[model samples]
Target: MFVDTSKEVRDPNVSAIAALDEPTRRRLYDHVVRRPSPVSRDEAAAALGLARQTAAFHLDRLADESLLDVVFERRSGRSGPGAGRPAKLYRRSTKQVAVNLPDRRYELAGRLLAQAVEESDATGAPVREVLHRKAQELGTHLGEQNKTEVFDLLERYGFEPRCEGDAIVLANCPFHALAREHTETVCGMNLHLLRGVLNGLDEAGLEARLAPSPGRCCVRLQPAA
Candidate 1:
């Protein structure tokens, strides 16, 4: 999913990826990641034949984007007054960043599926039933966590919600590929998920239902009668 980092609305993973698009910055990142230990400004500069000022600027930028982590330590084994100030070092960040076009959340799906399988195996329950329950639980949690309007929440998750009459149609399905391949299973999960979302949001006005259409999500939100 792409979160416009400039707006600071969500995770900055996309911005972190964009930072590496610069030639020099990408090279500096590559160099730092390959090292056995954190690299200092001087070491990185000398290795890349870049000026110290230029190397410092890019390294700090990488750290700022959270692509790299910053650490300070004394290179010399001295302590007290003579030891001098700690040297700033750069290393690859522990944070993980993944971006998908059209906003596929396969990892989220995988987690739900895995939880369902594990729970079913332990409880001797049906896997499909467990999957739907898990999906709904997650959706409820998402709705409760995000206090925004329904349309904004859907857009944040890449549902691409659109208005049609008194109902909301999703123009893009976040689980497009998976739902296409496993129609019944995925669509059912999606329906329950949105239902739980509405429930958590205390949205008594809208009810989520299955109304599959081409080029749209399987679930549609319609006004409750």
Candidate 2:
């Protein structure tokens, strides 16, 4: 079956809070999301009930961040064909931000875990160790089609892995710490699935280490087993 989700052009605005206070940042995100097309600095400001000058200042800053690109330059004002200048139009970028959300933290953790370990095998070490041996387990799991499937599965679980030294390391897993706070039941399970995900892959060929704490659950890669 096929479904058509009407295409929506994305707002190329990333959260640039350095110059803007939190409130203004939120307003900017909202403005870009709701705006039909690239809006003039003045229009954006008016939408947020801010002054034109202030809006221009922030808009330019957004452009610097690659979050916005100028689509057209125009001069809008009262006058004639000989008007002083025209305003610029900025179209939203085609990039959109999608957030992963879970209805129940525990359940969400389970789904994440289940997805992470789809390609795990236990050859050495604790053949079926869960929680304690997540990275180890996931190392071995590969797909019948190709290793790419295994790698992709990890990505689906939001595990961005990169090769380092002798092993594959998880670049980022946003759920790592959050799962700990949300509930302990699945945090352990998460580790378990992670292990299963790595299972079967040569242990000695790849080493996975929970990066130094205070990090967002990045598994450092190296030779294992």
Candidate 3:
């Protein structure tokens, strides 16, 4: 799973012994995602109406794959006469492991483009020309900010940045679908704008790179055009 932190997590490692197939994976994903808490096997079973054993199997699988982190309530220094083991707690990892982001993507993009249209009309600039100019400006702006605070800035923009020394890794974006679907159209335009923005910020030669796969999302952008 960590093989490529630069790419979004795709088909996260699920335990084979736990009997987690794609369908089970989806159910388990929904269960954890809706609550964002560590649920016991019994709790997940009840939530999904599956057998306790079945739930346990899947929960273990998720943990093995690193999708879920298990938390154990440590046994007191002094154990009771009959106390066996500490209760195990389960919770979602802090990672932004979401499955989709079409709505938010379109929402942000629409606003940006709409504003561009209004500004173009106000200045009597050709729509395409104005957009191209704006794209450059935005790209330059982003580049400058990323120069010193790439991680912090990306987080603000909803892009998960996992820093490894000098390599700034983008784990995911809230606009994966929008970016892919409109890459050459709306998304491409946005990417160009980001390029311009980053260039201005001195982050030249950056590129947007996304891993092509299911259950993963991200757009790695270079600062330079």
lDDT of each: 0.91, 0.51, 0.59
lDDT, residue 3, candidate 2: 16
Q: Evaluate candidate 1 by giving its C-alpha RMSD to the native, one decimal.
A: 2.7
- Candidate 3 whole-model C-alpha lDDT, 0 to 1: 0.59
What's each prediction's clash count?
0, 29, 30
User: Candidate 2 vs candidate 3: which has greater lDDT?
Assistant: 3
Deviating ranges (above 4 Å) for candidate 1: 1-11, 78-81
lDDT of 1 by residue, 1-225 (tens): 324323757448888999999999999999999999999999999999999999999999999999999999999978899899999999999998888878887888889999999999999999999999999999888888876678877888889889999999999988888999999999998998898889778889999999999899999999998
Segments in model 2 whose C-alpha atoms lie over 4 Å from true places:
1-21, 75-86, 98-225
For TM-score, the strongest prediction is: 1
For each candidate in turn, give its C-alpha RMSD to the true structure in angstroms. Answer: 2.7, 12.9, 11.4
Give the distance in Å from residue 58's predicted Cα in candidate 2 to where it truly belongs: 1.9
C-alpha lDDT (0 to 100) for residue 101 of candidate 2: 39
**Off by more than 4 A, model 3:** 1-107, 119-129, 139-148, 163-169, 204-218, 222-225
Give a tens-digit lDDT track for model 2, residues 79-131.
76776675676655454433343212334555545544552343333322443
